[model samples]
Target: MNITLAQAEKAIATAKEKAKAIDAKMNITVVDAGANLVAFGRMDGAWLGSLDISIKKAKTARYFDMNTGIVGELSQPGGSLYNIEHSNGGLITFPGGVPIKNTKGEIIGAIGVSGSSVDNDHTVAEAGSKAI
Candidate 1:
């Protein structure tokens, strides 16, 4: 099943709260299973660079049907599918992107965030997913 607007809104709200808690502005993006954008937000004062990175991370999660951290590991030197990272607009081979799974463990979409440390980005993304 596809991600609904309600889910997107929940994700955005949670992301905003987490970003506020850390006192860090952020760019958050949600993408459907097919890597299509569902929703996006740029917190005030967030770095412009995070705009693109957040989308790329969401796309990475959507494409891989898993967290971007797992994809990053798979793309490391001597790892399988290392070349895959070079495709699709150059997704960053790092953490901070996470998949959103339904109750049956099916991935319906993903969320990503940037404009902070990778750890903080991951925390926000996780918060968003949990909110959904």
Candidate 2:
């Protein structure tokens, strides 16, 4: 199932809260199960460059139905997924991407956050995903 606009807004709201809690200005993005953009939020003072990065991160997560960090690990030198990022028109294989799952544990969408450290980005994205 795809993520509805309401759900996407909820995710963005939650991600914004987490970003504020950590004193991070973030660009948050959400995508449906089909890897289509659903909603986005850019906090005041957030890095302009991170806007695209956030969107790519969410799309990347939905594309693989897994965290981008995991993708990053597998894409390391000599790893099985090495060079995978080069495919898909470029992907952010680092942190800040998380799949959004429903109560039935079905992945419905994904959330991605940027403009902070990788750890913080992941944390915020995780918070957003859980909101769904």
Candidate 3:
């Protein structure tokens, strides 16, 4: 499965809308199945530091085909994947990343959001994922 430009745009838009709803300024990113960037947006007043984190969050989700939070939980100290984040040039193991799936249940891409609380970011990313 692949993500077209329109789909990427839609995801970003939805993520931004959700962020606004939560009174957050966020950086959002979309990546295709191949873990390549497809689209990205930074809301005005978002943290500059979160730009790379947003992109990495999307890549982390696409690369593992799972939400970043689950990965974080799994990879915690003494967990099954302890220190796994240190691999693949590091990963954003916290919340705010989700896979984009097609009707056939195939992951077509992923969305990531940053510049907010992890819970809020996860919600925004979910909004974007659902839009796709």
The residue pairs that clash in candidate 3, if any, are none
Ten contiguous residues minimizing lDDT sum, candidate 3? 82-91
lDDT value for candidate 1? 0.87
lDDT of 3 by residue, 1-132 (tens): 799989999999988988888899999999999999999999999999999999989999999999999999999889999988887787998999999998899999999899989999999999999997
> Candidate 2 residues 69-103, lDDT tens each?
99999999999998898877889989999999998
Task: Please rank every candidate by TM-score, starting with the best.
Answer: 2, 3, 1
Error of 2 at 5 (Å): 0.4
lDDT of each: 0.87, 0.94, 0.93
lDDT per residue (tens digit) for residues 2-71 in model 1: 7887898899899999899999999999988788999999999999998999999988988877778888
Best by lDDT: 2
TM-score for each model: 0.93, 0.98, 0.97
Query: Comparing 1 and 2 by lDDT, which wins?
Result: 2
Better of 2 and 3 by lDDT: 2
- Count clashing residue pairs in model 3: 0
Candidate 3 to native Cα RMSD, angstroms = 0.7
**Model 3, residue 77: what's the lDDT?**
86
Off by more than 4 A, model 3: none
